[model samples]
Target: MSVTSSDPRIAGARAAPKRGIRFSWSDPLFRAIIWQIVIVGIVVGIGWYLVHNTMQNLAARRIATGFDFLDRVAGIPIGESMIAYDSSVHTYGRALVIGVLNTLQVSVVGIILATIIGTLVGIGRLSSNWLLARLTAFYVEVIRDIPLLLQLLFWYTMLQGLPPPRQAWSIGDTAFLSNRGIKLPLLEWQTAYGFALLGLAAGIAATIWWSRRASRVQEQTGVRPSVWPVAIGGMVVLPLAIWALFGAPLVLDIPALRGFNFQGGGTISPEFSALLIGLVTYTAGFIAEIVRSGIQAVPNGQWEAARALGLRHGVILRQIILPQALRVIIPPMTSQYLNLTKNSSLAVAIGFQDIVSIANTTLNQTGQAIEVIAIIMAVYLTISLSISLFMNWYNARIALVER
Candidate 1:
């Protein structure tokens, strides 16, 4: 039989596809439009309710919300600010800056020290020797189980109960330990100190160059390069050279017995000492676990292959294991860094005068809780974003390209 347009099937197929749109839930675009409309409605409704509630609550509480309080003199005294912070001369904005600096000071130093300790402990936990592995595990478990605030209190109490400065314990006549915290010799700075600082910067740049060169050489030749000499020369020799060139602008500000208290040297307050020690110890325990897991993630086949290539244990770890492990370690490490930075807020408990502490004081003095809390949140958000950006960039650099 021949087909014709007048036939039912033929006519249905040729009828311009019915000239009608059928709505179906299975259509992804339809579902997406529905979702968007629902989400926008919910969000807008919630926002409106919140704003209405906030206005009513503020009126009931007789609370005014604005940023004008930042200009008012923060009459609160910040003990242990980096700069002179009397209740006399600074605005709340200036005091907030000082607090931010203090937070950074503790967090930066704590991160560096924690990384060093954590890496060593992590490596020890992975040791072939039974004794080292057990010891490291014990340390990690013990420190991890305790709350950091409690640890800070313990360290503070212990340090604060030490003998007075007059009878301070001395280590080789260079450092003093007492209830006043550790007193160490500081270099009295002169104009020439700037050159020494430049030298230190140059040394750091040289070290980075050397490390990159060494890594490239190892990758190409399968030969490990010595790092100790370069480390010593850059860290020790270069700084010394710069100091000498600048006629050594450092005068030892030795702590001398003066009447009843020690004089002339830099002192660390008990609050600072306790906070740093606590943060370092607590953060390091978690970092140790991250490092251990990262190291363990490298396949056994990798170790065997490297061994078959006649690589020593150290070479295998450095060239084959650590590079791979770092990729695993870095993402979790970003979280730990962010945690440590935010934990610096706990410094308020000990009167360490970090950003949170100053903000709290400013709030109390100015009755601007909303503004102060907002500022604290903004500062922390900025810090977290910065750290995230840097770590992500570095992580991308080290990440392996997958085919």
Candidate 2:
């Protein structure tokens, strides 16, 4: 006998492995994979068929489909745009670019304002003062109940009802509010401003680096270095120094009445004003609820434990509560962000001329409805995916790790 092994596992392990597909319904993993592949194939096939059929019908009807329309001159009159755009000079592409910028301009600012307002309202909802809590609750209820479209219309009408430029409400003679919209002093921009901005950006980057280093040092030494000094120097002092170095240009272009309207200054159009006010007010209501719920979702024990540590109320809330609460808050917050961006499309109703408004104009003028629709879908999908990815990454980063 040559050390005969009776164990089935050892014998099987020593045996040559079987090769080739074993088509058995009892093999769960294999069957599941096979079914998934089959389903995916069917979906792909159906999609291809639909696309092919659509193309055939379009061609038969002589409906041209391509992005070539983007090259055509866009004679569409845009009231306001971020970039240099003229109906007589620019192509459809440039007009669309302007629309995108306008949309981003509204969306980015709306998101920031909404987040700040919502967070405050959410905290206020749990305030010790009965009046503050009740007031915040009232705000959330009333704002959420009313339709956003109606709000937009109300704001637009209100702005339009303002007095003419000649008799406009003056803010210390530096700004004016009129039916033409709010006119403010425009910065006479210079190279020095750009250098100051660059210094600010660099400062921010340096602050971040120093913060990370401090965090690592704290982990190793159990003594946390304060990051505020660096933050202030980087964010404030550095920019001021750069600006002073470049002669500290602080020129302004004050608006003056020109015939029927104000000129020579920055103007916030009524359309944009209405849209931003509507979006921020409407979205902040929902976001407030999300924030409130997320905060409440934390166990009472967490609060008690934080208090036991003798940490200040602000520090405990910021360092202990929020980190845990974010897990609940972020997923819903991402949805609200997407909603705000998509809702910006409603700007068309108020003549804000966001991306959707521009694309609609493009389709009507070019007779390339398909292309324009595709562009719209692609833009929204890209933005939504980007928000989702960032939120998901952040959520995973702050997630509690198991030992």
Candidate 3:
């Protein structure tokens, strides 16, 4: 019954370390690398095959490829521009640039107006007043439900139905509003206006600095500095001061009824007006919904707490609600802005001469459908990417991070 120093049977039965196939084929890292290699090989093989086929096809069809088409005559006239352009003298590149600028002009103004209108409607929709809420809801539903193209057509048709310039509606002898479009006084500027512009720029910089200082002071002293002064000073007082000191430095030119049409004033043109209005109205509906959702995402407790701390409704919304809600609102709002920009291409239907319209003409003239389409895609892609990157950066700035 005495046990030996070690149990002999147990020692004898003990297994040796198995050494065969130390690195198994099923290792995760190995499998991942193998899978990646296979995927890449497939992609490269397909790409090469397609590319070869394309080259052969192009050769067979006798279609030359290069960027040389850009240097050729565009032979297309642009409606509005910062430079002189004619069908005879301008290159395709110049034509494209004009188109791009027109697109930007509409998009920028549309985004600003849409944001203002959308925010107001969104706030109205959340109002305690039943009438206001219902009105806002109706606007959002009607606009968002309709197709944008149809809306554009409606506006255009209404505009074209207006009486001729001789019978155009006049506003107090200084402005004109008509189905044709709005006409306003144009300013003729002088040298002193340049200095005034400079002064205005300086004033804006000062106002921004003051705003940051006020924010800092509030953080330390718990006393919210009045923003009204900075806002008014930057927006109104400074600009007025510059104008007064320089004797306004500009002459107002009002339109006069001359012959068949009004002359000597700036015109919005029926086509441009319709396109801009349609774009703003259509995009604003979606923007309003985004704003409402963003505002709703903030907890009701925040509002109650702000009121408990003696903040007025405006102050509470501005300080506590909007700052938080904007973090949610901005990302989607950026998308609407992008959509509006791309949608401006619909201007072609109304003869607004946007990039797509000009590009279409160039394509038809040169018979380079492939190259023209590529250019259009590249332009839109560039615009979309730039907007997306900016929104992501802004979103990151306000995005909440958890430890």
Candidate 4:
């Protein structure tokens, strides 16, 4: 008989080798953490270097750094101001506030005018009439190609080239236009006007609430109620009634020619007029293209389907097309608005005295270059972020809800 030996030591020697503590190059989590840490370290190092360099430079130059300069007297005259500002009496902060208001004024008005004109041009670009479509395309091409700064300069020159105050252009006795500026009838305000405004606001809220209720009712009853008549009645008629009841606390102060200029009413300065015109015309071109593309993004079948349902052209456009096209149009339109606001900074070149222009003056006066620039940057950043947030919220509200 052959002797066969199976020993425990032989089995232990045949076992697989044990793995010790080692680095794992293929672990996704570990690699990601390592890369993040490396990037953060580099960024921190760079930031530290910049801060140190800036502090050293400041110290060497003996440049005082702080926002205390804002409280100093601003002995600078502003061309246009929404709030009361005296060059000798107001602080630098107050002057800057006026500038901010002016910027907002131009931006808001420009955006409104641009959207209206752009939407019209966009629709015209797709018109059935060949002439209208060709004309719209020409406008888009010409306006978008020219530089906005050049456009502003040209407009300013044209305005300045107009007749002097003695030979001012008049649209009746209520308004005047000249190289100096445009003068218009202003409404004199009163205490009752505030109440009337409140009433009008309430009417608007009620109209919105009614519209929502109407929509829900229609959904449940398969009948769409006409809300426009009620909306108009509330928005217009109610406000007018309230105004009349409050003794009509509004008086028109018509512009009149005085010694050397038109006075006694509101004035739109040449600088403001030029800046507004340039901003509106330039921004409208891009907005027109955006609107056209948004409308075209809708399938042709949508139009055919609406027609098959016997819907009128206006009804189809308002009820069917725009609601859908707005989804595509809003995002790009928001960008154009932001660009318009930033471009308003170019006002300094033409002496419009916007926030940026005024801040530049402050920097030169106090030699607080860093502080002034930082303030300007912060203001612009805040405005841009606010617009972005609003537009994003609006976009979400109108976006499709797919099941």
Candidate 5:
């Protein structure tokens, strides 16, 4: 070292270590804080300007601003309501509640039906049967290509074009289909129905616990328990037994043609029927694609390994492939669900009184445009957030963890 040549490395080695720059603007932590402060300031400034402008406009027009308008009587009649609602007696707030329930009813039912249809189609597209696969592929292509609104309108028109009530199509007098709508026998609920529902809830909880236990058993003994039988017994047999013990508290209200319309049973309005059909069919197409991609993403080696272990096709799919494919399928599946929910707002176009429809009517009648819009936004935001949280939890539960 004392006899070092004119080499930069040797000279540097001989020299004392240099200190790093301190308190520089390039420091990550300092830069982050500065950027954050700037963003906050910009956001606050924008929000204040908007609020001030809104206030000035409201004051100029002498328009009263508050939620007190919610208590005013809603003179408009809702076509379909889950709860008892009268135009003369109910407030706008109550109307909005009815609308919310209607939206939930459609969204929940649509989700369940879409999932079933989509899964079947997804599996069909991968089937060994040529005809089935082609048909599935055709279905996905046709549905995914068409506009949802047009499909909804078409369905509504078809429903309305059916024969009138007097000449309606009947299924053994148990159900009736006509321009009026589809009328089916209704289940009349009694006080014991509450207990039966609780029993069903308990049964579902038991099924979940049993499934976890069965998984552990399979891991230890390399033998899987017959879970389906146990699950069915818990969910179906136990619930029925509980219902029977409670004197089977259900009454069937059958529909009968009376005068101009079918009377005395549950009825599905054409608007609701159309909206449900469109949402399910449209959303199912996207879900099918998601599922197909997920299945294809699983390595061929995994399938080969399962086959080598003498596993049956069903077992291979259920025990191995599905578990892996779900890790891929769930995230996109969640987005489809959210899309279906938000698309339910399209019910407004056809006079199916969803939250948006009701809110619009409220805004027009009360001239509370700002409040109505705010309420609608809040409702949708809440629903979307709730769904996102649930999906995230489920995704985490199924996600792969490397050790």
Candidate 6:
């Protein structure tokens, strides 16, 4: 060996690789960072040019901009709104809020229904019964093949072809289905009921916590606590107790036949009905596939192992396989949920006044296309982000931890 430097400073300097970034193209990290900065700068420059050009053009046309228009009278008629909307009274802002509510209403209900139906069908597809499996498979294949917009049109057409309000289908005058929509007695909501609903929500959270705690107890002591009693108490008893504490106000706003349409109760407009039906069915097909794949991803050895422990098929699925399969199921299910929410924008096609539909109307009425489109994008972004965050948290919660 050649004489080596024993001085600490000299030895350290000799051993250490070169410090600071080299400007040479041969340095991969330096090259990557430089190219990235250059690309970013170019994109920023282009964006600035486009925005500046558009502003100049708008100014030349003397077209007023910004959201000052939201406070002005909307004067836009909205057929179906969750909240009160008077075209002569409300502003564009209120109209947009109504559109968001309608979109959220359908999206929330559709997600719940789709998840339930999808999970059931997915499990059915894996059943030992040949007919059941084949039927589920047929549904998945057919639905996945058809375009969602076409399906929406089909459902809307079917609903539109129903009898008019005057000759509508009815059940003892309490409920009616017609070309107008589904008319049902609205449950008169009370403050007490709202409190009870809050209690129910709290109970659900408690139930989840208790289940996790039970799992930990089982893992540590080889004895799982009975969870059903706690589940029933928290979910059912707690809500009922809260309701009772508030005197349990129960009132129904019954619908009455008046003129061409029903009054005094809720009406699920044909557009709303068709949109909800189409979304639930279409989304269920995709969710079914996701669930099936998640279940299949679990190894067959898991089933045999559970059986060896003298467990029933249903118990094995619920207690063992599914908990593991969730690691696979949750990620894709999140994408489906996001898709359903975004696709709800297609509500405009059939006249359901979702955000996109109302936004388009607002665009025409206000002649502020930029502001209107921005509002639409912002609403979708907020909703999609909320869904993603919740799903990501759940995925993390269920992820396998190395011991």
* Winning candidate number (lDDT): 6
* Candidate 1 error regions (>4 Å): 1-35, 172-174, 196-249, 256-263, 401-403
The true-versus-predicted C-alpha distance at residue 15 of model 2, in Å, is: 18
TM-score of each: 0.82, 0.85, 0.84, 0.87, 0.84, 0.83
Whole-model lDDT per candidate: 0.86, 0.89, 0.85, 0.89, 0.90, 0.91
Worst 10 residues of 6 by lDDT: 12-21
Report the alpha-carbon TM-score of model 1 versus the true structure. Answer: 0.82
lDDT of 3 by residue, 3-40 (tens): 35377754432321232222445544455567899999
**Model 2, stretches more than 4 Å misplaced?**
1-45, 198-238, 245-247, 400-403
lDDT for model 3 comes to: 0.85
Per-candidate clashes come to 0, 0, 0, 0, 0, 0
Q: For residues 1-403, could you state the per-residue lDDT of candidate 5 as single tens digits?
A: 2535888766654442343333668654456568899999999999999999998999899998999988989998999999999999999999999989999999999999999999889988998999999999999999999999998998888988999999999999989999888999998878777777787888889889888999999999999887898788878888788889888776889999888788899999999999999999999999999989999999999999999999998899888887899988999999999999999999987779999999999999999889999999999999989989999998988774511
- Cα lDDT tens digits for candidate 1, 263-286: 888888889989999999999999
lDDT of 6 by residue, 1-403 (tens): 2337587766654443466567788665577689999999999999999999999999999997999989989998889887888999999999999989998999999999999999999999999999999999999999989999999999999999999888989999789888999899999979988888898898889889999999999999999998888889888999999999988888999888798678888888899889999999999999999999999999999999999999999999999988988888999999999999999999999999999999899999889999899899999999999999999998988884411
- Report the number of the highest-TM-score candidate: 4
Ranking by lDDT: 6, 5, 2, 4, 1, 3
Q: Output the TM-score of candidate 5.
A: 0.84
- Model 5 scores a C-alpha lDDT of 0.90
The candidate, 4 or 5, that scores higher on lDDT is 5
**Poorest stretch of ten by lDDT in candidate 4:** 13-22
- For each of the candidates, the C-alpha root-mean-square deviation to the true structure, in angstroms, is 7.4, 6.2, 8.5, 9.2, 6.5, 6.1
Cα lDDT of model 2 by residue, 282-401, tens digit: 999999999999999989898899899998888988888887888889889999999999999989888899999999999999899888999889888987798789888877777744
**Model 3 CA deviation exceeding 4 Å by range:** 1-31, 178-180, 209-248, 257-260, 400-403
Candidate 1, which ten residues in sequence have the lowest lDDT sum?
A: 13-22
Tens digit of lDDT per residue, candidate 4, span 157-188?
Answer: 99999999889888887888899999889988
TM-score of predicted model 3? 0.84
Two-way TM-score contest, 2 vs 6, winner: 2
